[model samples]
Target chain A: MRAHNLALVLDTVATSADPPSRASVAAATGLTRATVSALVDDLIAGGLLTELDPPPRTGAGRPAAGLALTSAGPAGLGCEINVDYLAACVVDLTGTVRQHLVEHADQRPAAAAAALAALGRLAARARLAAEADGLVMAGAALAVPGLVSAGTVLDAPNLGWRDVDASALLRGVPELADLPVVVDNEANLAALGELRVPGAEQTFLYVSGEIGIGAGLVIDGELYRGVRGWSGEIGHVTIYPDGRPCRCGATGCLEQYAGQEALAAGEPRAAAALGIALSAAVNLLDVPVVVLGGAYATYFDRLRDGIEAELRRRVLTAGLAPVTLRAARLGTNAAVRGAADAVVREVRDDPAAWLRRVG
Target chain B: MRAHNLALVLDTVATSADPPSRASVAAATGLTRATVSALVDDLIAGGLLTELDPPPRTGAGRPAAGLALTSAGPAGLGCEINVDYLAACVVDLTGTVRQHLVEHADQRPAAAAAALAALGRLAARARLAAEADGLVMAGAALAVPGLVSAGTVLDAPNLGWRDVDASALLRGVPELADLPVVVDNEANLAALGELRVPGAEQTFLYVSGEIGIGAGLVIDGELYRGVRGWSGEIGHVTIYPDGRPCRCGATGCLEQYAGQEALAAGEPRAAAALGIALSAAVNLLDVPVVVLGGAYATYFDRLRDGIEAELRRRVLTAGLAPVTLRAARLGTNAAVRGAADAVVREVRDDPAAWLRRVG
Candidate 1:
């Protein structure tokens, strides 16, 4: 009960638009002022929270000290392994990115071990930079463009990889071996990153367009990972059904028409195909918004009209509730940032665990 | 807390495979035997439960009496409005059907009021029959093949219903005015009905193939009703962009190829189109099972091969975790039974509410 109350108090302070005084948190959470103060003290002692300087007195005897998440305590290390790039970032407890690094390379030709080793080096650099800024690394998460489950990449056709043990590969790097790591699909992570946008909807589909198109389904503020963690394979959704054969042994998959290669080749039907596929998602899932990320964000100006035209015509609820479409605010950085945010969230969700570990 | 404990105890008995003794329920729920006995007594007095005769014992001094839900109280009234049929049924608390009636007629040309009036009369007959069987009508639920929200049928294309105030129409019928009613999409209700099947997967996509194609997504034992209750419009999912025009003002919709009319016309591409559209759903939603209901159940053997082939070929995780396909167990009766079941569930879930009302 104490742990739960501590987390509740911390979350209250973290999510408040303005720093909240202990009394305000007590009122908001329905906890007594004494209980709130005790919980806040524990959080402050654990370095999970800090009391902000009191505001200048206007007409009162003394202004209350506002509470906020500590920025200089713990941070998250995020790494990304894509077909063409490796990136890493460090995010602080206050949801601020402290360090970011991107390396442009054709990772498709590299072995899984080599790719992970490079990512390890980049993550090490980001970690050192964060440490220099008085932040300790809490944990790490890796984003891969593939079907990831239990720290293994089941398949990434674009990277010519399958069943790669990502955790073992990362463990080989001495700098990353001690850091706890979680692996997830890049699109899923990107969706989580977009979820942190100030005014984003709690439920929407986040489409990641790249060499292979993938999607992340955010339902009621949580990523819907599906039964086996292989949901949102929108790239493989049938578009033409017979127009073009796909490497996945499927005919006329959406990727064949609207993937990065197709869009680069200026495929005339890419926008229409995307619209058709998204319409199916919206109709079936009733997700009211679609966030276009990755290459789609880059080409949103060109694709928006064609996609909207098809959506208006194909969606059943268009007249009553139009599906909103928008570009990814974080653009190419969503996946890495989302990975870091996930680690930060883990610490915020269970500060007791972090406190116990540190103690 | 008492009401919650009452519902929990009732649900435990209701879902138990066999009638359980009060001692067994106490053990299962971690409540004291005295508490269980008191709750059971209240439930028995409220006509929600009954004590079964003890089984003959050889070694024991006394065999404990078993508890079961009462069959003679709080019956549910279910009605379905479809393009070709109007059906009503009464289901007792124990889930036994006491009465059922179906009228086959083309309802598209009839005004919504005329059609609902006929349904009200049918429901009244079923209710009277249930009353003769010693059951009291608790409430009613009506299922329609269209978009329903707030007791209004918004756009049932096959039935030519748009913005029809279903509650108002039913209220005009004195027989049903006094009964509490809920309006739901037929496919959603049918999926709920199928959820009651023993050993059924809690998450699956139920496709209802009538004159129009609608789908119900069940996730984690609950229906995934989208924002505004407009979800699972599988009929509008684009199949072959620009292939064929549809009455919903869309081109290449799955309904254009796999609807009941298309199958009746022996459309050669019906099976293939169904496979493609279902593949898209499986890919995006990652629902591991697909239950074909309505017309699709009748043609399951013919459509299974084509749909499975496409799912295996198109779904990204088909090799590792193949999507399972099955036919609806209840067949055409699923929607009406599900509607009735919904009402019965309401009573079972909150027996205290009913007891208060009756008192």
Candidate 2:
């Protein structure tokens, strides 16, 4: 029953365009009026939902009460750190974006602290705004342009950061310290972001941009985190055995040939590997829909056709369902929006009590 | 209560190595004796289960009646076609293997008729065995080694066939015409086989070995069939752009690179590409567990270190749970076993009269 109710509520809110009333919930779910009231009450007590004012109906004898996200409830903050800038957003229990902020930065490791400080201030403002709007932050997630292991940024060659401790950096902000701050590769988060986008539950892949390329795979609506959390890293797939030197000390890594800066600035000859490399990845994964996002999405089309052609030649299945390649709907805000969504998942799913008391 | 009773019967049977008595089923599922009796009646009425003689307990007053899967019920077949051979196995409703058969054939499309004849002969033998034991045949499934879409094999490089009508192939056997037949990629069936493996629910990436290499993916215990039904075609990922031309007219696809024949022939360079390509794939998916079966599992040790190192280069987040890379327990039988298991899934989850009807 608990699982069923959770599914019903989450499914309802996720599918509905706007907040609904108890009567609607009952009507859609086919539960009794009393059952709807009981479920709604439980959800309210659990702090996973709120009551909103319903719009007046033309022929209604009595006005229905509305339910929506509460402003003073717990919230989540998600920050997407790209190659040259950062974007952040805060969300409440109902998946509402309360605040979004972006900042620019240098790629040097030395600039990381200053950028972190700026991020701290931006997060402080978001928390304050969330509080003003009656939502308290329950958690925050930080996505970076590198390989992250636990709280440490192990290797972000593009940023020149070697084993940078992102969790420690976020810890400097007292307002964000106590919350469970998650940090991972920006691409992985973008993949999740794309998967959560409306109507992305089937098989889909996300190609995230920034310093390097990262792919996120979702099969049947579940994230495919390969052994060791490195399932979608296509940038370093060794496109040329004798290609340009990769930051990871390997020649011919896909990043050297197709990475954002590499593809953007390198001669077209260098970009020739994009088709072969991406086709290699696509053929292996067999994802029907591929969404390109990140700082490099716009520029990626320069090589998209070649990759698709190569895929046509190499994929085992001919006449495959046309792989829909589209720009991400969330665009530049994919990571931040996805970050806020993680909180939405938590609060909506009924997390720890204190954390559960959300918008 | 109905659902609970159904789960009880299934769970009890799943847990028991040998058949259990009705009283034992009642105790195991926490149901009243009357309820257990009533449910068993329903189960027998559906063809899914039957009664059997219990193994005598040393000091028992009287032997308890053993409840077991009905051999007279519906069955599913997993037929595998490789470069030069065809194999089929019949599975009972409980997912138990009842019969297995195989034959060799030329890769020529013209030989499809001969292969169909072989299948008909095998089916006849299987039917004879089932009738000798008083069992009823239910359904059959075919696992093709190629790019299958909508009941057709569009291309199977190993088999050197294209656009072969798989659904029509079964018509060669008149007895099978009345039965439901399913056809899918062999690799996909292998992945389902892994999902049905006892005590395992983690994501599974099943790679099969026969003539050429193929792969299957299972995420969250469900087969991840891409939109075109062409997902899990890892063999065709072009790892080499300008290298050796493959049968598919592509250079450096995983199959052309590390396929069974390629690896067996000592394609040192191709073997190297195998590890790197898989490493890149695993890292990109963020799936912590990878079950390596089929062609690659034999030389897994050769590919392990390189794949792991390459994976480390691409993976971003480091989670505490270590990614598990293990060989499949079912060995070459995974698909046949999985075909049987698929029948169990359909029978157990839906209102199937075939499963419930008893003689």
Candidate 3:
């Protein structure tokens, strides 16, 4: 009961626009004030929460003490291995990034061990910086630019890696050896990062663009990994049959049309192709929101008009509710941040598990 | 505890290949023999379950008295208003079709009242047959060839229906006046029927073809009705960039290439176009199975070669697990059977509700 109530209080505090007081938490959670106070004490002791000064009141008998998430508390470590770079970051319990680093290096030609070693170095640096800031490192997760299942990279065409154990790659580093390391697709992580944004739509698609195009689906604020965690391969979605050949050996694939290389090279049809493809996605999934990330986010201003025009022409429900297209706020940093946030999500979803181990 | 145990017993009996006795049910559900017996008695009295004679055995100390769903118990009524036909069926607790009827009628040009009136006649015929067989009609659901949400047929292009109050259309019939009717897309119902098949894949796409190509997604054996239930619009997916115009106004759409009219006319490009489109779906969703329904199933033998070749070439997981393509077992009857089974599914998912209503 204590663990459950603690979660409830944490949720109420996390969702409130302003810092909530013990009384407010009790009222919101239907728990007694005494129980809320006891739970808050336990949470504060565990470094997951903190009490704040009373807010300046306009009209009140007495200002209630405010409670909020601790700034320098248990933090999560996140890393991402992309085709052109490796990134790592540390995020606190309040979803704030404390330390981050990105190393740009062409990874496609590098050996799997060498690329993983470089990524490990970046992760270690972030971890050291996080420790210096007086934050306890909780857990770590890695985002890979490919299909991943059970912490193993099944296939990464851009990285030239296949069947590599991603968790094993991180185990070589002593700082992360004891920590649980989860491996998932980078696009999926990016979507999770967007979903965690305050006041973001609960259901939307996050399209990530690099040399290749991929998408991550968030349904009801939870990332949908699909069976076997092999979903979000939108790059291979056929666009124009007999139009352009893709590296995946498919003709007229979306990647051949809307990929970073295609758009950057001044292909006149790139944005239009993206729009036509997105129309199919909207019609098939019935999701009303789409967030462009990575290169797409960076170049969204240039491509927005063409994409919207295509949507207006192809989308069946364009008249009912115009599909909302927006640029991803985090851009290139989203994958790494999402990886770190994924680690934090574990504790947020089940605080009792954290309490069992730490309390 | 009694209500929960009753549901468990019904679930176990429904899933079991052979009739299970009270002892077996107790072991399966972790309930005491007395508890199982008491719940079984209530279910039997409610006419939801019945005792069956033990199967003849060559050697046994004593035979266990078996239990099974009663054939003459409460049943579900299913009706379908398609582009070319009106169908209705009654399915009992055992998942057996107790009564069925079908009438050919082109619904596109017909007035809304006229089409609904014809559908009502088909529903009445099935309800009467079910009553003659001593089966109690539980509920009714109608499958239309279009988008549906909130028990309303929002739009059915082939049928030229928009903002149709389907339940109100059936309310005029005396037999169904008191029965609550559900309205949904035909493809969605077909997918539900496929999901209910014994040993069916947990996640798959069911493609229903007739005049247009519509799809239903079943993820983990439940229909994935999008937020507003406007999913599975596969016909609108673009194929050729500047090809023949579709009724939905998109140029070079899949429906123009692979719809029933195209395939039936022996267009050589139809099967190939279907393959290219399905490849996109497989890559995007990573659902390893695709079930072809309606005309697609009837003509599977002819389209098999082209579809298989495309899947082999385009599916990313072709090296890991080749995407399996199979014909829907229920074929033409899938929608009607699914509509009836859907009503039965409500009770199967919660047999205690049926027990409460009757006992």
Question: Per-candidate DockQ versus the true complex?
Answer: 0.81, 0.41, 0.60
DockQ score for model 3: 0.60
* Reference contacts preserved by each model: 0.86, 0.63, 0.60
Task: Compute the lDDT of residue B146 as modeled in candidate 1.
Answer: 91
- Local distance difference test values of all predictions, in order: 0.91, 0.69, 0.85
Which ranking of candidates, highest lDDT first?
1, 3, 2
Among all candidates shown, the one with the greatest TM-score: 1
Model 3 clashing residue pairs (backbone) = none
The residue-by-residue lDDT of candidate 2 on A232-295, one tens digit each, is 7777776766567777666677777666676668546444565565566666666667777875
TM-score of each: 0.95, 0.82, 0.91
Better of 1 and 3 by TM-score: 1
Q: How close is candidate 3 to the true structure, as a TM-score?
A: 0.91
> Per-residue CA lDDT of candidate 3, range B1-359, in tens?
76777888998888888889999999998999998999899889888888998778769677788999899898999998888888999999889998889898678888877898888888998998889989998899998888777877777766777888888897668878888898888889989988887888889999998877789989987788777778788888887867898777678888898987898788899888888778877777788899999888899889988988888877776777888899999987888899999999888778888878886
Model 1, range B248-310, lDDT digits (tens) per residue?
889999999999999999998888889888889988988899999998999999898998988
What candidate 3 gets wrong by more than 4 Å, as runs, is A1-9, A16-42, A51-66, A170-178, A351-359, B1-6, B16-42, B53-65, B351-359
Question: Between the candidate structures 2 and 3, which one is better when assessed by lDDT?
Answer: 3
Q: What is the C-alpha RMSD of each candidate to the true structure, in Å?
A: 2.2, 4.8, 3.4
lDDT, residue A336, model 1: 94
Q: Assess candidate 2 and give its lDDT.
A: 0.69
Supply candidate 2's per-residue lDDT for A236.
70
Candidate 1 CAPRI-style tier? high
